[model samples]
Target: MTTIKLHNTKTRKREDFNPIDDKNVRMYVCGPTVYDRAHLGNARPVIVFDVLNRLLRHVYGEDHVTYVRNFTDVDDKINARAAESGRSIGDITAETTQWFLDDMAAVGALEPDHMPRATAYILQMVEMIEGLIAKGHAYAADEHVLFAVESYKEYGALSGRSIDDMIAGARVEVAPYKRNPMDFVLWKPSDDATPGWDSPWGRGRPGWHIECSAMADELLWKEPLRQDRLSEGAKSQPHVFDIHGGGLDLQFPHHEDEIAQSCCANGTDEMARYWLHNEMLQVEGKKMSKSLGNFFTVRDLLDQGVPGEVIRFVMLSTHYRKPMDWTEKKRDEAEKTLRKWLDLTRDLQPSDPTTFAPDQKLLDAVADDLNTHLALTYLNALTAQPQKLLDHARWLGFLGDKARQDDEKARSAYTTSMGSGASDALASLANRLDELRQTAMQSKDFSQVDAFKTALLAAGVEVRMSKTGVDLQPASNFDLAKLDALK
Candidate 1:
């Protein structure tokens, strides 16, 4: 068995992963809050944990690994969007949820075993909040149930911050009723205008932190192995999941509050054994912001005709712990590499991941703290063996028979409309692009190559370059007449 190692944010160390039950490996990554389209930043944890899920399934049989990613359907953002758009909250949530699904699928993320909607788990969340109040871990004040952060001595353990520090640095809701400055809401009352469910406290909605804790308990945790079976040592069953992951930004209040709520409510010492947090993402070397004119949703990139595979490649090119900078130059290089890999393995067919043996080094790279960047390096090394490359790419969710079929359909359409001459023209342009690059390489100047690249792009050609050479692929918007300028 390949031993897996992961960096645990809670412990702040890279440690060997030992699942409590080898037959079942469970992971929960926080999913999108479906108020709007999932932006590029939202895709980082999705891809990071998607890779982790794949690795888990590869190790523990596909059926044994259960991955849960939830949808935060009920949020202030959703309510505001509904109000601003003058649409019903339910309708907006449903539409945004589907959009999130479609956008993630384009980026090659697998649907998790359980994609629980926060609204669907409201009852469970309510029950958990009630339990917290009963246990003196929470209290109801001002029609809101707030977790007593001071009640849990280890409240800031996961984030490594003292209560005083958090109180000073935190953007705490300045509520007159909160017992302490750092106390967080477990449930809050909702007016007739806001989405609410009847509960022991009042007509209220679950706070963000309680939703995930309850959902994980329902979906991932085993039901205490039946009381009768506990005599056989089942009482020692793990309290929660093997791994919990999200962006670093969540590490402070959201995750810390979850730890306090779950541990205090359940009488357990831990919530998740390993906590993994991926770093934030940037665009064009600066924070992605609408003010910066760099804000882009995943759908926006897809609409720009950047393939999901290329986006994923650019994402995984950097380690999860390192802040990823999304740059056009990197996108171009990633597209170029994928073009070569797809072309190299075009004749081959994708198969079941189990049917083909992945390169040992590739597997090793993945196991070593999910060194995905190193794994990509290993994937790059497998180019000479098309069969090996195609199978491995399929295992990684890149190239598959469906992708080929789609390409073939496009190729067929092109051949039918443009005739056979179009094929020769593309090859000629590819050769021309390569000749320009080779001459520029010797001259220590890439002015001509950049000029040709710009023109080819204008004509809807996706230019790819590797040490082997340049590969020119016609994009969906290819214009045959525009190539005459380059000629």
Candidate 2:
């Protein structure tokens, strides 16, 4: 068995992963809050944990690993969006939830074993809140239930911050009813205009932090054992899952609060054995912001003809702990590489997944803290073994059935549309673009290159120019007359 090592945020060290039960391994990753489209930054943790999920399934038997990612359907953000858009809360949440699912699926991510909606688990959340109050870890005041942060001595252990530091660093909500400044809300009163559930305190909704804790506890800790899906050893240690993961930004208050709530409510020292957090993302070496003109969503990239495989490839190009910068140069390079790989293994049959075994070095690289960059390097070197290359690429969520079929369809379409004469014309146009680009690079003026590229794009041709040269392909709306005019 390949030993897996992960960087645990709780301990801040890379440790060997030993699941409580080898027969059944469980992982929970915080998922998106469906208020709007999932932006590029949101996709980071999705792909990062998606890779880890794939690795775990590969090492353990496919059926043995259980992955749960939650959907936060009820949140203030969703409410605000609903009010601003003049749409019902349910309508907005349903639409945005499907958008998130479609965008993630396009990025080659497998749906987890469970994707629980926060609204669906409101009863569990209320029950957990009641347990906390009974245990003297929470108090209700002003029709709002707040977790007593001082009650949990190790409240800031996961983030490695003291109570004083948390007060200073976090945007602590100072309420007249809160016992301490750092105390967070478990439940808050909601008016008739807002979405609310009937709870012990009043008609209100669960706070963001409590939603995750309750859902994770219900799905990972209790429900699995209740269903007899886990071995006896796994059930012995309740309230502790194998791994919990999210982005670094969530480390401060959200995750810290989850730890305090789950541990205090369930009488456990830890909510999860290993806490994993991926670093943030950037665009063109700068933070992605609408003000910066670089902010976009996963759907944005997909709409611009950048394939989801390319996005996943570029994301995994860097180690998860490092900040990943999305640049056009990197995007072009990734597209080129994936196209080449797809061409090489176009008609090759992959090994049966049940009996499939990846190259040892490739598996080891991934197992070593999910060094996807090194694993990609190893994948790039497997071109000689076409079968290995195809199987391994599929394992890494690339060149799968859809990708191969799409590549074949595109190639066939291009061939049928372009006779020998038009093929020569397309090649000639590519050579012309290459010459103009080289000249512009030397002269430091790109007016001619830009104009020609714009014209090609207007004619529905895909223009990809890189350091090597220019490669042009005709789209479904290709215009031979446009090419002749350029010639």
Candidate 3:
């Protein structure tokens, strides 16, 4: 059994992962609020978790792992969008959800096993809220049900904040009805204009935190939640899940609140045994914000002609623990590298798909806390063996069967453009650069070497030189006519 080490935010250490049930390994990652197209920052966790999901499927059989990423359809933002667009709430959510799917799929992410919507589990949310109230962990005031943060003594354990500090620094809703400033809403009354469901309190809907707790409980928990608050043997029930994850931003109030309500309602000590969070993302060394004019949706980049594979490559080049910066330079380098690899492994397929396994070192890198940057290093090493590199890259979701079909078409076009004369011209240019280097080494005043290199770049031909020789390669937009002018 290969040991998997993950940094658990709950324990604050990279501990060995021991599944509660190996036969049914489960994970739940916080998903998007479907009010708009997912931005680049939003795509980070999707890609990060998708890699984890793939790694899990490889380690544990594909049938053994169950990954659930939920959709937040019932949000104030969704409702506001509905009101502003003058469209029905259902229409807005439905359209936005499909847009999110299309954009995430474009980024080489495999869909999770479950994508639950908040609206579909209203009954479960109400049941869990009522159970929390029955356990005295929550109370209703001013037609809004609020969870009593004081009731959960380990309230700040995950976020590592003292209650006094939380009360002072937290930007909580200062409603007169709340018992404590940190007390968060479990359910809030909805007006006739807003989306609502009939509840014991009034026409209302579940709060943001409660929706996830309820959904995860119903879908991923090993056992149904213990509804009866006074059952003696209830605490021993198997309500715990394997892993819970999301962006680091959700660590404080959102995830903290989920833990409180879930433990209280289910009569368990823990909701999830392990917690993980990927760091945020940025654009060009600055925070990705709309005001900065850098915040762009995933679709926007795709529309701008950046291949989805390039985006994924640039993203995975950095570990998920560090903040990722999206830059055109990174995209260009990623595209050039992918093109080179595809050219090396073009039209190659596994002789036997059943026996084709990912390279062990590549899998080991992924298993060790999802060190994707290290996995890429291993991938670079395999470039010498095209067949092995092709097999491994496929497991990492690059140059798969479909991508190879496209690669063949592009290779044919590239071959047609670079005939015998063109190849002869490229070799001649390489020899010229090599001769220039040798002359420069002796004269120490060969301005001609720099001049020729500048001219080659102007003609859009990438040039490389070493002690032995020089190499020249063409970019996607390489101009042969410009190269002929240089010649």
Candidate 4:
């Protein structure tokens, strides 16, 4: 078994991953709010965790891993969008949820084993809140139930902040209630117009932090659906799952509150064994925001004909722990590289099924706290083994069925524009041009090289000459007839 290591945000160190039940490895990542389209920054954690999920499936058997990402359908943002757009909350959430799934699928993310909606799990949230109140960890005041932060001794352990610092530095809701300033809401009353369900605290909805805690407990740990897989001890208290993950922006308040609620309610030392968080993203070296004029959604890029694989590749080139900068230069470079790799492996067949496995070097790179940039560097050196390269790239969520079909169509069109032997002829011409350039470099004379380059340009071929070699490809306005003179 490969010893997978991950950086735990709770401990702030990289450690070996030891699952509570290796036969049933579990993970939960915080998902989208589903109020609108997911912007470019939103795609970072999706891609980062997608890669980690793939690795988990590879290390453990595919069926052994259980991944759950929740959908926050019952958020204030959804309510506001509904009122502003003159649409029902249900209609808005449904449409926005589908949009999120489509955009995420475009980037080659596999759907998690469970996608629990917060609305569907309201009963569980209510039950958890009741338990918290019973245990004196929470109290009902002013038609709302708030978690008493003072009751939990290790309230700020996850975020490493003192309650005084949190109160001073973070936003604290100063309601005239009998509680500490850092106390958070577990359930708030909702009016008849708002989306609400029947709760002990009147008609209301669950707060954002408690939603994840309840849903994660139900789906990942204590669900009756997976009771058969549980041990006698696990069945008693299954609150501490293997991994919990989200973005760095969510490290404070959101995740901290979840930790406090889950631990205090379930009577556990920790909510999860390992916590992972991917850093935020930027656009062109600046923060991505609408005010910065660099903000765009994933769907926007897809509509502009940017291949999903290109987006995935550019994202993976940066380490997940570091801030990723999206730039046009990086996008173009990634596209060019994927094009070359796809063309190289076009004629190759899939590796034998019995012997099928990802390259050891690449797997090792990713296993080291998801060093995707290094894994990609290892992939670039696997061209000599085309089948291995193709298989490994696919394993990393590249070169899917669509990409292969698109590459085939592109190659076929280029072949038809020239002749049946056009590919071979172009290769021969590229070699010939390279020889001329090498001779010119040695003799300090470039008459032949310059003339060949000019002729190739006139024929609508993009001639790229470098120290590496010469590469020739048809441009949009390629004229096969003009190339006849050079042939």
Candidate 5:
């Protein structure tokens, strides 16, 4: 059995992962705040962490791994969306969240073991707030209760930001009721028009960060265990779980506050043994935003006929902790790579009795903190040898009988529509692109190479350049005459 090591955000170092029971490994990933359609930026964490979850299930038994990803159903953003759409908050959240789930499923992200909603856990949130008040970690203001930042001495440990710095950086409005600038709201009184629940403090709603802490404790740690009659004298358990993961953007006040709240309420030093944060995704090396006109929703990409698998592959190509720049060229390259793998395994016998012999070095790379980039290097090595590539693609969840069938149908339709001479023209263009790309590489003129590749793609040829060399294919249903006219 391979030992899995992960970079623990809490300790700021890489550490060997050892589950509490060695039989039941529990992980929690912060999920989407579903107020709008999920963007391509949002897809990174879903696919990257999903792969990690798959790797865990592979290492441990499937039933032994429990993964929880929560949905933030009750948030200010949801309320604002509800108002904008002229729908109830519940309706908006439910509809958008369903869309999010569908998009994630399309990208091959497995449904979590539990998808706890903030609205469903109101009672738990209330209980936690009451506990915090009783413990003197929180206090009530006029119709609201705020967590006392001063009470938690280790408040800055997780984010490495001093309380003063946090106060300065905080975008939160300073309500007159808050005791300190750095203090955050646990419960804020709700108006008649807004969503609310009757709590000890007042009729209010849970704060955004509080929902995750409460839900995680309730669903993961505090749930009762009812054993079957076969196991006499079986005891309920409260053993520590393993990991918590989210985007790097959450490393600040969000995760820091969660750690403070959960540890203080539970009276434990560690809320999560390991904390993992995947880096953000950028569009053309700029932050993705609608105002910037670079933002792209996952649905938008889907509507453009980009396969969900190709999207997933592009997300996983970069290291999880490294920022990835999304570009059409990258997507085209990933599509070509997938097409090659698909073509290699298209005619292979289903029961060919191929051994599941993945390169041990590749496995080691993945296990050493889920280095997907290195794993892809190994994948490219396999692709260099077509026979070996078909066998190895199984490890990537790509080149099985099912994958072959699916790709063959898609590929045949794609190729037949391109006419007789189109394939040969595409092949010639690919060869030219490779030669030009190589010259660019030798001259270290990557910009020109990128432009040349884009030109080929514009002319209805897809090209992938990697360490192993260049691989190319005709675009799906490409119209060579139309392409030539456009060029």
Candidate 6:
């Protein structure tokens, strides 16, 4: 087994990854706010970290990995959207969250093991706030409770900036009740329009940053006192997780604040052992924004006929930690590459079971904190050699027919234009195709078997049966260049 390494935000260095519990690996990634349609920029972290989660499960047993991603359904942004749309916040959040899940699924993002919502964890947030107040790390003033920035000595450790520097850099809001310029809200009183809950302080709502910390601790942490001793003799040992990931934009205020709240409340130096942040996706080297008219939603891209896999491949083409520039040409190139891999594996016989030697260099690149750019380069080099391309693609989870169709249309336009030699080539192609179809039939892969037969027939190949199996040959002459054009 290969050792995976990750860049830990806390230490600001690439380090070998070792899970807290060898049997159970835990991870939590911050999820969407659910105020509006998720833009392509937002999808970067979702897909990038999803791949990380997939890799972790592959490395460890599937059942051993616990990946938690939460939703901020009760935020100011959501409240504002609800007010503007003339709908209740609950309805708005619910609709947006559903849409987000659908879009993420389209892009091949795996659902997290746990999808905790902020509204569902209000009690947990209130309890954590109470604990902070009891511990003297928080103070209530004018019906608002604020976390005392001076109390947490390591507040700026993750972001690598001094408290004074952060204060100066931040556009700190001047509130009369706040003790320090850097003190942030834990809970603030809400009015008739905003959602509120009865707490020790008053009728208020949980602050945005505090929601993630409490939700993570609730879902991922197990305290002995909270365990039921009657049903279970003794509390199970705590399973410390491996990773916490999000976008780079969260590094300063969001992630930094989460670290402060969780560590200070739990009385532990380590909340999550390793923190990972993916770089943002930009358009023409500028931050994508609606105001600039450059923002693109995932649905928009899909509606434009850009395949989900192509979008995913483009996202993975760059290092997860480096900014990716989205361009039409990039997507075109991704589509072309995906088509080549699909063609390479189209006639592959399952019985052959091509054994691919793991590309050590590619594995090393990915293992070293997910250097996807280098890994992609290695994959490209392997594809340049005809024999190893299909095998290499299988390891990358991009070789199967489903993965291919996810990008290219069912029948390529190029294949339709092939006039003369295409039919002749189909005869040779049919021989190899028949072998794969028979293997699929024997394995009871009815779907693949059906698809192979249909594709061959559509491409002017005729199949006939013999005692052993099926035999196929082309119907007439067709142009190969025209087929390439369709591709």
User: Using Cα atoms with residue i matched to residue i, what is each candidate's TM-score against the true structure?
Assistant: 0.89, 0.88, 0.89, 0.90, 0.84, 0.79
Residue 53 in candidate 4, Cα distance off native in Å:
1.1
Which lDDT value does model 3 have at 433? Answer: 83
**Highest TM-score against the true fold, candidate:** 4
Kindly list the per-residue Cα lDDT of model 3 for residues 198-250, writing each as its tens digit.
Answer: 99999998899998899888777633432332133323446778899999989
Ranked by lDDT, the better of candidates 2 and 4 is 2
Residue-pair clashes, model 6:
12
Q: List residue ranges in candidate 3 displaced over 4 A.
A: 222-237, 350-354, 405-458, 462-473
lDDT of the structure predicted as candidate 2: 0.90
lDDT of 1 by residue, 1-487 (tens): 9899989888889999998667777788899899899999999999989999988988888877878999999999999999999999999989999999988888888889889999988988988888898999899998999999989999899999999999888788899999898889889999989999999889989888999899888777644432332223323754566899999999988889888988988899999989999999999899999998999999999898788988999999999999999999999888778777877887776666565667778888888887989988888888888778888877776875556666778767977998867678878988888888888889989998888888988897877788988777777668989987776
In candidate 6, stretches whose alpha carbon ends up further than 4 angstroms from where it belongs are: 223-240, 347-362, 382-409, 412-487
lDDT score for candidate 1 against the true structure: 0.85
Summarize candidate 6's per-residue lDDT along 154-212 as a digit string, tens digits: 88888999989988899987999999998899999999889999899888898999998
RMSD (Cα, Å) for all candidates, in order, is: 3.9, 5.4, 4.1, 3.5, 5.8, 9.7
Model 3 alpha-carbon miss at residue 1, Å: 2.7
Give all candidates' CA lDDT scores: 0.85, 0.90, 0.84, 0.88, 0.78, 0.77
Model 3 lDDT, residue 89, Cα: 91
How high a TM-score does candidate 1 get? 0.89
Worst 10 residues of 4 by lDDT: 350-359
Model 5 weakest 10-residue run by lDDT: 226-235
Whole-model lDDT for model 4 versus the true structure? 0.88
Candidate 5 Cα lDDT to native = 0.78
Count backbone clashes in candidate 2. Answer: 0
